[model samples]
Target: MSLPLIGTLKLRGRLTLYVTLLAVAPLIISTWVGANTTRQMMQDQVHEMLRIEAEGLKDLVEASLVERETSVRSWAEDSLVREALLTGSYEQSDAVLSRLQLRYTTFTGLVLFTESGRAVSASTPALRDSFLGQDEAVRNAPWFKAAQEGHFTSATLTQEDPVFGMQVLHLAAPVMESRGGRRLGVLLAAYDWGQVGEVVKAALERARSRKNESFALEVRTASGTLLFDSRGQDAWHVPNAVAAEAINGPEIADVGDGWRFVALSDPEEVYATVNKLRAGTLVGVLAVVVLAALAAFLLARGITLPIARLNRVVRRIVQEGDLTQKLEVRSKDEVGELAESFIQMVDNLRETTESLQRGTRVLTETVAELTRAAEQQESNITRQAAALQQTQVTAQEIKQTSMVAAERAGAVLQVASRAEELGRGGALALTESMSGIQTLRDQVDEMADQIGRLNERAQRIGGITQTVKGLADRSNMLALNAAIEAVRSGEHGKGFAIVAKEIRTLANQSIQSTAQVGDLLEDITQAILKTVELSEQGQVRMEAGLAQARTSGDSMRALSTIVQDNMNAVRQIANAVSQQNAGIAEIFNAMTDLSTMMHDTMVGLQASQRVTEALREVATQMQQVARSYRV
Candidate 1:
C-alpha cells in the first residue's frame, strides 16, 4: 500500500521528501540523545549540589549545638556559681547567673538543679516558681538526669517551654569541687529556638546564594515534618504557580538526633539551560536540513530537466513525422551523450529516407518508360495483325485466280488438239486458235507479275516483324531495370517489384510470340519464292503454246507436232500451277500461324500495358507515402 502511494508522488515531491529524510534523520537522533544526556547531566549536577548544600546545613546545625553546649559548660564551672551552688545560696547564684546570661544573649534563662530535684537557683523568677522539676520529677528530667552522670552535656533539640512561653533548648553541666570531687549540682542553660532557626536560615541562605535564582531549599525533621522551606510552599510537591516543579524526598542531610536538613532545587534552573541548548541544536539542525534540501532540489532539477527536454524532442519527432530534428548538447554528461546519440540516429534516418526516395523515383521513371514502350508495342501488334488479315484475304484471292488460270490453260489445250486435227483444213481456224492462245499467254503474264508483287509485300512485312521483335527485347531490358530499382527501394518497393515481375513475364511472352511470328514469316517468304518460281515456269509454257498456234497456220504436219509439244508444255504448266497452289496452301497455313502469334503478342502487350498502369499507381502511392515525412 505504501509502495503504490509513493509511486503516485511526483519526482520532485519524492525527491524532496527523501532529501529531507536523509538530511534530518541523523539530526533528529542526535538531538534526542543530546537532550537526554544534557538533562541527565543537569539532574546529576542538581543532585550533587543539593547533596553538598544539605551536608553544609547539617554541619552548621551541629556547630551551633556544639557552641551553645561549650558556653554552657564554661558557665557551669565558674567559681562563683560552684560555691553558691555548694552552699545552696540562691541569691548569690542568681547574681552570677544574671551576669552570665547577660554575657550570652542566646541563653533564655539559667537555672541550678540539685541532686534532690530542687531548683536551688534561677535567673528568671518566673522559671524559679513554675519549674517542673519540683522533687523526683526534676531528678527524672532529661537535662538534670544527663548532668547527674557527672559529664558535660546539652539537649539535642530545642523545644517549646510552657512556663517561659517560648521555644528553648536546655544545656546541663555538673558543678563539683576540684580536689574532693564532691558533686554539687546541675547547671542548666536555656537557648531560644529563634536563635537555632536564625542559624539554620543563615546557613541555608549561604547555600542558596551559591546557586541560580530558581534554586529552592527545604529542611525537614526525620519523621518527614517540614522545618523550613525556601519557597514557603509544600516541600513535597510543586506549587501550581511555578513553571517548574520539584519532587519529594529531594536531597537530605542529618543534623543529629533525628533532625533532617532537606534541600530542594527547582528543575526550571536546570531545564532552562537544557532548553537553551536544545533550542540552539534545533536551529543548527534546521539550518543543515534546509541547506541539504536546497542542494537536493537543485540536483534533482539538473538531472530531470534535461530528461524532460529529450522526451519532448522525441515526442515532436513522432508527432510531426520529421526525422531531421536534432537535439542540442550542452554538457559532456550522460544526458548530453544521449542527445548526441539521438541526433545521430535522426541523421541516419534522414539519409535512409532520402536514399529510398531516390530509388523510388528511379523505379517510377523506369516503369513509365516501360509503359510507353508497351503501348507502342501494342500499337505495332495491332497493325501487324491487321496486315496479316489483309494478307490472308489476298492469298485466298490469288488461290482462286490460280485455279481459274489452270482451267483456262486446259481449255486452251483442248483448242490446240482440235487445231492439230484440222491442220490440213484451214488457216482461218488456226489464226483463231492462235489469237485465243495469245490471250491466254497475256493472262498468265499478268498473274506472274501479281505473284511477284505479293512476294515483295510479304518480304516487307517480315522486316516490320523483325523491328517489333527488337522493340520487345528493349522492353524486356527496361522491365529488368525497373525490377532492379524496385529491389533497391526495400520494403516500400515490394509492390513495384511485383509489378516489374509481371511486366517482365509479359515481355518474355511477347518475345516468344515475336519469335514464332518470325518463324512463320520465314515460311511465308519461302512459299512466296516457290510460287514465283512456279509462275515463271507457267509463263514460259504459255509462250511456247502461243508459238505453236502461230506455226499451225503455216505447215500442217509441223503444226501438228508443234501442237503436241504445246500440249505437253500446257500439261507441264498445269502440273506446275498445281504445285504452286499446294505451296500457296502451305503459305496460307504459315500466315494463319503468324496471325495466331500476332494475336498472342497483342494479348501480351495488353497485359504489359495493364501491369505498367498498375506500376504507375504503385509509384504514385509510394510518392504519397514518402511525402508524409520531411527530409
Candidate 2:
C-alpha cells in the first residue's frame, strides 16, 4: 500500500507525516531486523547446546557398553569358568558370573553358553532358567550367533526381559581356550537399558540447570524405535508443536550398535530474551515517533504563521489599492527579509506612480505640438508630390531606352557566343586529331621495332638454311665416294652402291628443300626490311602531322579565347546597360512611391489630429489612475 500524496496535505500535516515516517521507519526496520537476528542466534545456540548434550550422552552410553563388555570378557576368560566349560561343570562359573554382575551394576544379567549352544550358568537364576529352557532360541539369537563366530557384538534392539520386566541390551563375547585357540563357549551379557536412559536424563537436567527452559531427550534405535523419552511416552510420536512455539531437535549422535540420541527444547522459553528486546524496541520507537510528530507540528505552525500574516497584508493592499502600506520585520530570518523586500517594493511602486502622473501631463502637451507639425508637413508634401510625378515620367522614358539598348547588346552577345562555341569545337577537333596522330606515331614506332626483330629472325633462319644445305652437300659427297668404293668391290660393291645411291637421293632432296627455305627466308627478310623502312617513314610523317595538328589546335584555342573575350565584353556592356536601366527604373518607382507617400501623408495628418485628441484623453485618465493610489 502506498501512502497519500503529500502535495494534497497542508504544510503542517505534511511535516508531521514526514517527520513521523522518518523517525519510525528506521526504528521499525531495525527492530524487525534485530528481532530476527536475536531469534536466529538463540536458535543456533540452542541447537549447538543440544548437539553437545547428545554427543556427551552418546559417549556415556558407549562407555557403559564397553565397560560391560570388558567385564563379561574377563569373567569368560577366568580359569574357573574355562575349566567349568571344559568339564561341563558350571557351578563355579555361575558364581563367577554372579560376582561380575554385582561388580558391574550396569549389567542387568550375565549368561554363559556352551559351544553346543546350551546355557551353563547366568548371573541370576531366573535368567539361567529362562535361557536354558530356550536353547534353540539362544542358538538362533543374533548376539549368540555372533559370539559363536568369535566376535564381540552388541544387540541393536533393546528388549524387556520376561522374568525381570526390565529393558535390556544384549552384549556377547567369545570365550576361547588358552592353548591352540579353540572355541570354548560364548559369554552373553545383558546391559541395563535404563542406565542409557539415565545418561540422557542427566544431560537434560544439566541443560535445564543452565537455563530455566523445558528440554527433552530421547534415545532411539537405528530403525526409529523409541527406547527412552524424557516425557515418558512408550510409543514414538511426531512432535507436531508449532515451530515458533517449540524447538524440535534431531541433534543425533551414534550411541554404538545403531542407537541415536536426540534433544529438543521449548521455543517460548528459549526466545524469552529476544521477545523482551523486540518489545522494548517497539515501545521506544513509538515514543520517538510521537515526539517527532509533535515537534514537526509546532515547527510547521511557527513557519506558516508568518507566511500567513504576509499573505493577509498583500491581499489587503491589493483590495484597497494602497502602495504606501509597510510590513514590519520582527526577526532576522528569511521571513523578515521577505517583509523588508515587500516594503521596499511598495515604496518603489509609489514613486513610480507619482512619476507616471507627472509624465502623463507632459505627454498631453507633446501630443498637441505633434498635431500642429503634422498639418504643416502635409501641405509641403502635397506641392512636392506634383514635382516628383513629372520627374518619374522622364525617368520612365530613360529606362525604356536603356532596356532597348540592353536587348540589342544581348543579341550581339548571343552571336559572339555562337562564334566562340564554333571556334572551341574546331579547337577540340584539332586537339583530338593531334592526340590520334601521336598515338599513330607511337604505334608506327612499335611496328618498326617488331619488323626489325622479324628481319633479324628471318636472317637467322637464312643462316640456318645455309648450314643445312652445306650438310646436305657433304652427305652427297660422302655418298658419291662410297659409291666409287663399292664399284671397286664387284658384287659386294653392288649392294653397297645401291645403298649409297639411296643416301645420295636423300641428300639431294634435303639440299633442294634447304634452298627453298633459304629463298623464303630471303623474301621474308626483304619484306621485313621494307616494312621497317615504311614504318620509320610513317612514324616521321605522323610526328610531323602531330606537330602541325598541335599548332593548329593551339591557334584554334587562341581564336576561341579571343571570341570568348569578345563575348565577355559584350556581356559586360549588356550587364552595364541593364544595371543602368534598373537604376533608372528604381528611380522612377521611387518617384512614384514618393508621390503616393505624399498623398498618404495628407491623409495621415488628418488622422494624427484625431489621435492627438484621443491621447490627451488617455493621458488624463492615466493621471486620474495614478492619483487614486495613496502614495
Candidate 3:
C-alpha cells in the first residue's frame, strides 16, 4: 500500500500487478452492469408474458359467461316456455330445460318461475323439488326480481346445492308475450364457477409446456374474494414472484361479476440465462488478467536485464580499482548508448591515470634536488653567520678604542684651553707693564724740567743775598748815632743807649750769617745741575724699557693666539674622534644585527630543506598509488 514498499518489489512483479489491474478492472465493472441490466429485462419479460396469459384467461371466462347468458335469454324467449307460463303447465318446459342443461355442461341447473313467482319447471328432479313450491323465495330473489322487471341479470359468486357443493354464478332473463312483448315469467341458470378455474389451469398448462417455466393462476371477485387458484390454497403467495393482473370490466363485460384474473411466475427461473452470462464473463476476465501479467513480466525483463549487466561491470571496476575495463554494446537504444558512453569514460580515465604516474615521477626528482640545494644553502648561511659575528666583535673593540681616543683628545683640548687662557693673561699683564713704563718715562721728563727751573730760581736768590748784606752795614751806623744822643740826654737817653747797643750787636751777627748763606746757595746750584742731568738720562732709559715691554706684550699676545689656535685644532680633533666613535658603535650594532639575521636565514633554510624532503615523500606515495592502477 505504501509507495516505498511497492518500490522494493522487483520490476517484473510491479509491472505485472499494474497491467493485470488495468486489464481486469473494466471487465469486472461491465460484467456487473450487464448482469443487473439483463436481470431487469428478464423480469420485465416474464411479467409481460404472465400478463398476456392473464388476459387470455379473462377472455375465456367472459366468453363462457356471455354464452351462458345468451342461452338463458334464448330459452326465456322460446314459444314453448311462453306457452308453459301462459297455461300454467310444466311438462313441455321441463323437457326443454332438461335438454338445455344436458347440452351445456357448464350450467349446473336451470329453473323457470311464473309471473306470480312460483317455480313451475326444473332441469332435474332435485332442482324441481327443491324450488317447485318455493314461490315466495324465488320471487324475493334479486336475479328473479330483475328478470321479472324484464332485465337480464347475473348474480355474484355463490355456492350451488348441497349435492353439488361447488361455486357457481346465477343468470336470469324474463319471458315476453309475442304480440305486446309483455314480461311473463323468469328463467334462471346456475353456471358452474369451476369453468373459470379450468380456463386458468389450461392457460398455465400451455405456458409450462411451451417455456418449461413454473406458473400460478388466481381468480378473485371485484372485492378480492378468492374464487379460484391453480396453485391451491395459500400456495400463490410467493414474495419474489413476478405477477400481472387482468380485471374483468376493462377486457370483458360482467364476467364473474367484475372479477380479477392474475398470473405469477418465479424470478429465479426468469433470470437463469443472465446468471450463466455473468459466470462466463468472470472466467473471461480472469483469463485476460493472466495474459496481461505475462506480457508485462516479459517487458520488464527486456528493460532491466541490460541495466543489471551494466551495474555488475561498474561494481567490478570500483572494487578492483581497474580503469582498463570495457563494455560491450549490443543494441542501438538508450541502454546501448549508456554502455558506449561508460566505455569512453573508462578509456579517458585510464589515460589520465597514466599521465598522473609520469607526473609523480618528475615531481619526486624535483623535490630531491630542491632538498639537496636547501641543505647546501643552510651550511653556507651557517659559516656566513659566524663571520658576521666576528666582524661585529671587531667593530665593538674599534668603537671602544675610538671612544678612548676621543676622551684623550677632549683632555688635550681642555689643557690647550687652559694654556690659551694663561697666555692671554700674560699678554694682558705685559700690556699693562708697557703702559706703566710709558707713564714712568713721562714723569721722568717732567722731573727733569722742574729741576732746571729750580736752578734758575737759585741764581735769583744769590743776588738777593748781596743786597741784604749792604742793609746790615747801614743798620750798624744808625745804632752808634742813637748811643751818642743818649749820652747828651742823661736819664731818657740811658734806655735809648741800651737799645742802640743791642741793635748794634744784632747787626754784626746778621752780617756774619749772610756771608755763610751765599756759600750754601752756590753749593745748591751745583747739585741742581747734577740732578737735571740724571733725570734726562733716566727718561731715555724709561722710553727704552716701555718699547721693550710693548714688544714683550706683542710676543705674549702672539703666543696666546698660537695657543688658542692649537686648542681649537685640538677641539676639532676631539669632536671628530667622538663622531668617529659614534659611527663605529653604529657599525658594530649593524654587524650584530646582520649576524642575527644570517642565523635566522640559516634556520629558515634548514626548515625549507625539511619541507622539500616531505614533498619528496608525498611524491613517492603518489607514485605508489599510481602504480596500483593497471593502466
TM-score of each: 0.44, 0.54, 0.46
Which residue pairs collide, candidate 3? none
**lDDT of all predictions, in order shown?**
0.74, 0.77, 0.80
Q: What is the lDDT of residue 69 in candidate 3?
A: 75
- Candidate 2 has its poorest 10 consecutive residues by lDDT at 241-250
- Per-residue lDDT of 1-631 in model 3, one digit per residue for the tens? 6889889997667866777777777877887788788878877887788899888988887787777777778888889999998898879999999999899988889888777777788898778777756688777877777777665444445445443466667788888898898888888888887776667767877877867466887877777777777876657455877789988884444436577888887766666677788788778878877887788778778877888889888888777877766677898899899989999888887888899899998998899789778878777777877777778878888888888898888889889988988998898888777777777777787888888889988988888888888888888888888889999999979999999999989888888888898999999998998898888778777777777777787788788889988988988888898888888888887887888788778778878877887888889888887887787
Q: List RMSD in Å for every model shown.
A: 46.8, 13.3, 39.2
Q: Write the per-residue lDDT of candidate 2 for residues 1-631, one digit (tens) a residue.
A: 2456666787778777777787778888887888898888877887777777766766666667667666667776888888888898888888888888888887878888887778888887878887656778778888788777755544545567664578776778788899978988888887777776666667667866878446777776666777767767543344642121111233432225666777666666767788888888888888887888898788878877777788888897777878766677787789888888888888888899989988988997898798788778767777777777777778778878888988888898889889988988898888778777777777777877887788888888888888999999999999999999999998879999999999999999999999889888878878877877877777777777777787787788888889989988988888888888788778877877877887787678778877877887888899888877877
> In what order do the candidates fall by TM-score, top score first?
2, 3, 1
Candidate 1 per-residue lDDT, tens place, 281-307, comes to 989888988988888888778877887
Best candidate according to TM-score: 2
Error of 1 at 359 (Å): 24
Model 1 misplaced regions, further than 4 Å? 1-10, 25-48, 132-144, 149-159, 176-184, 200-236, 239-259, 280-284, 287-291, 309-331, 338-631
Candidate 1 C-alpha error for residue 580, in Å: 94
